[model samples]
Target: PAVPAPPVPAPSDREGGRDDDTRDKLKQASAALDRRDFDLAERLANAVINSASPPKQRAAARLIHGQVQCIARNDQEAAQIDLRGLEGFRAMKQRLLNVCRKHGILGR
Candidate 1:
């Protein structure tokens, strides 16, 4: 009998998968923001936003990016992201609302 070739790993199993990679990137971005590294946070969040990530991931990235912009006093840019997409994520939406309120991006 001929030898059979080994089965290839699924996309999600390859090198910890794209979702994992993107998730990790988002976590790093959040950490950078926590560390007060605005530039790195923005870059990392933008990467996630521009990637082929799922809608939830993209929404989270946008929230993080908007928060960074708000912190940097770029209220216009921060307010440009319509957070309605995050309505399903109640906690995240609340956090965004709080951030916007604190930054004056949203009316008190």
Candidate 2:
């Protein structure tokens, strides 16, 4: 008798479905920001920022990542200095602050 072929794995299983979900969530969060839904945007942004994934995808998450850090810095005293020390953060610190200010997520 011929040997049976190995079963193929599903795409979702192979990809873990997490990255796609994160991307979708990030897009929704960005849309919420565009719609001035700061509260929802903040929630979604936090989810993406806190996700256990590589920076490549998270960095592409953009506005959400910014909003999460902005909110964290404003609400968590301990995170302020560390968040400020992030790469390219110091140079664009003022600009980021300005954005957060406009979003009402952070105080100037």
User: For candidate 2, lDDT tens digit of each residue in 2-96?
Assistant: 99999996667636788778888888888987786767776776677678756644544444546555554444332344245344544345555
Give the poorly placed runs of model 2, Cα more than 4 Å off: 1-14, 60-65, 68-95, 101-108
Q: Native-vs-model 2 lDDT?
A: 0.60
Steric collisions counted per model: 0, 0
Candidate 1 C-alpha error for residue 102, in Å: 1.1
Give model 1's clash tally: 0
Strongest candidate by lDDT: 1
